[model samples]
Target chain A: MPVNSTHYLFLSLLLFSIGIMGALMRRNAIIILMCIELMLNATNLLLVAFSKIYADADAQLFVFFIMVVAAAEVAVGLAIIVMMYRKVHSVDINILNRLKH
Target chain B: MAIYDILFWVLSAIAVGCALGVILSRNPVNSVMFLIITFFAISGHYVLMNAQFLAIVNVIVYAGAIMVLFLFVIMLMNLNADVEPQKGQLVQLAGVISGGVFFLVILAAIKSAKPELMDKTSTNIGLISDLGKVLFTKYVLPFEISSVLFLSAMIGAVVIGKKEETKPLTHNGEEE
Candidate 1:
């Protein structure tokens, strides 16, 4: 049996849900960032699958742009994380309460 | 089942399992390792979809570059399970419940929507050559704009991350 787009869609859904759970439950900022990456990857998978289903290249191009943005986002995000760590001496998100004051 | 179907099942299983591992691992380093595995598995799916260029880019950008950055930060932070305090059990339970609800709603939405399937004629759309044509001809503006975005991101990261050096002496060369 050939694989259908639904298979890929379901897989994306599962991965995305897991990423959401991790982002919500994790206290460490780094893990939360990683979870966000997971969510992005899930979207990429669904886009590529849809591109295949429709026999179109536009969605794949969109995936390419998403990857580019994700790369740039990761660079800046990790830099901010590093700076936060330097200030607080911890990677815990709960310790980020200084902004609330 | 055909080979492609088998590959899909196996790779999806690996990807989902690694995703779970990423969240559940106690050590942040372990979570990073699992995340790398998840990226590799997703790249495998890209290959099965005949997106060769994307598969290669996914491996290179995500597993190679981005994940290495994550690992370097993890090492620099020296994070462990013990150092990071856990949230309350109630909060953890609430998070899990909310995520589950979100997943169920999206799944239902996916099931309700019908996507028309096109005939498979080896479109070769996912090929690098074809993708380059469309990207350059049609999406050229966004492509160029993304480069500018990357440049700005680089400058911003450097500005934010750079350390400040304190000068001990005044301009008059006198220490207060």
Candidate 2:
């Protein structure tokens, strides 16, 4: 049997779901960020798979843009995290209950 | 079928397993390490998909640059496995339930997907030349927009990371 594209997409979906779960349920802010990266990678996988299926290069360009965006996001995100650590002395996201109100 | 397919499955399994480990591992450092594994596996996937340019980029950006930052933060924060808080049983159960539900839904969606196979086989697909052409010709606008976004984010991060000059506290123990 030939390996199919669906199989890769399926794995991507599974990984994305797990990442979402980690982002939602984890108390640590850094872990949540990692999970978000996982989600992004999952989307990247979907894009590359679809690009191959359709024989289009546009999707790869989108992936390039995504990588750029992801880099920017990490720069800003890590800075914010450092600032949060300075004030709170801890990165327990559960303590961010102040945002819920 | 072929050795390439077999290798794909093996690498994908490792990637997915590492991703799952990222979620389940209690230690943040371990989670970061697992994420590195996931990145490596994704690069492997890119290789299998014939996107050689993207595979190398994936390794360079995600695995190399981003993961280094993650590791640096984890070390700077001095996180310890013992410092992890214990979730209440109910909360743990709820997390597990929701995660399992989401996984099942996604799996079902995948099971329902129609498989599409490539018609013509091309080796050395999406070399640096192909990527440069498509990026400049087809997706130029979005590419430029992403660059502007990065610039704005760079400035914002600089501002956010700046150390605030705190005025001395007032007599009432509040910052003036």
Maximum-lDDT candidate: 1
- lDDT per residue (tens digit) for residues B45-91 in model 1: 88888899999999999999999999998887777445678888999
Model 2: residue B139 alpha-carbon error in angstroms: 1.6
Best by DockQ: 1
Whole-model lDDT values for every prediction: 0.89, 0.84
DockQ of each: 0.73, 0.68
Name the regions of candidate 1 deviating beyond 4 angstroms: B80-82, B115-120, B167-176
TM-score of each: 0.93, 0.91
Across A58-84, the per-residue lDDT of candidate 1 in tens digits comes to 999999999999999999999999988
CA shift of B80, model 2, Å: 4.0
> Candidate 2 at residue B99, lDDT?
74
RMSD of each: 3.7, 2.4
lDDT digits (tens) for residues B24-107 of candidate 2: 898888898899999999888788778999999999999999989988887888885548675667776787788779878777
